[model samples]
Target: MAKTLKSAAVFLLFFILILLTNYETNNMVVEAALCKKRSATYPWASCVPLVNDNSCETHCKNKEAAVSGFCDTIELRQGFIDITTCYCQFNC
Candidate 1:
């Protein structure tokens, strides 16, 4: 019966270790998802002809504590004019 008890203890320890590791990973994912979102208008003086993802990312990188960005178009002046802007995904 001692052998069975030892095996059971080992299994329990292994299970606890796996649970602890999963908990830590979940906490990291939750922390990453806690970032605040923000956006800014690109080419502030005028509108661009096309959406440039690289430039939009660079523009967001210029902001303080910006993580990453993408390009999107937004309407202005009662939805008449569509302007491209850089949307920053996260600020941590």
Candidate 2:
């Protein structure tokens, strides 16, 4: 009976060690990726025909210290003359 108890104790310890290792590894991976990529958008009120996409990207990089940026234009009015509004996406 004593030998059986010793074997059970060893098995229990090994199982607990495995559980703790798995839990820590999963927790660390989650923490690492929690903020891996984040993004934000802002209105570009000064957007005009002369403004280029590269300029918008550069502006976002400067303003938000972003890794990259893109300009998305949407036309509120659809007619012979369209009114376009520019929105900038910043990715970090």
Candidate with maximal lDDT: 1
| Per-model C-alpha RMSD | 6.7, 5.7
Which of the numbered candidates is closest to the native, going by highest TM-score? 2
Report the C-alpha displacement of residue 49, candidate 2, in angstroms. 16
lDDT tens string, model 1, 1-92?
Answer: 99999999999999999999999999988877765533444563222324433465666676534677666777888768977655666655
**Model 1 lDDT, full chain set:** 0.66
Clashing pairs in 2: none
The candidate 2 region of ten consecutive residues with least summed lDDT is 83-92
Residue-wise lDDT of candidate 2 within 1-92, one digit each (tens)? 99999999999999999999999999978866754534565555434436444465666677767665655555566655544433344332
CA deviation > 4 Å runs, candidate 1? 36-92
TM-score of each: 0.43, 0.45
lDDT of each: 0.66, 0.62
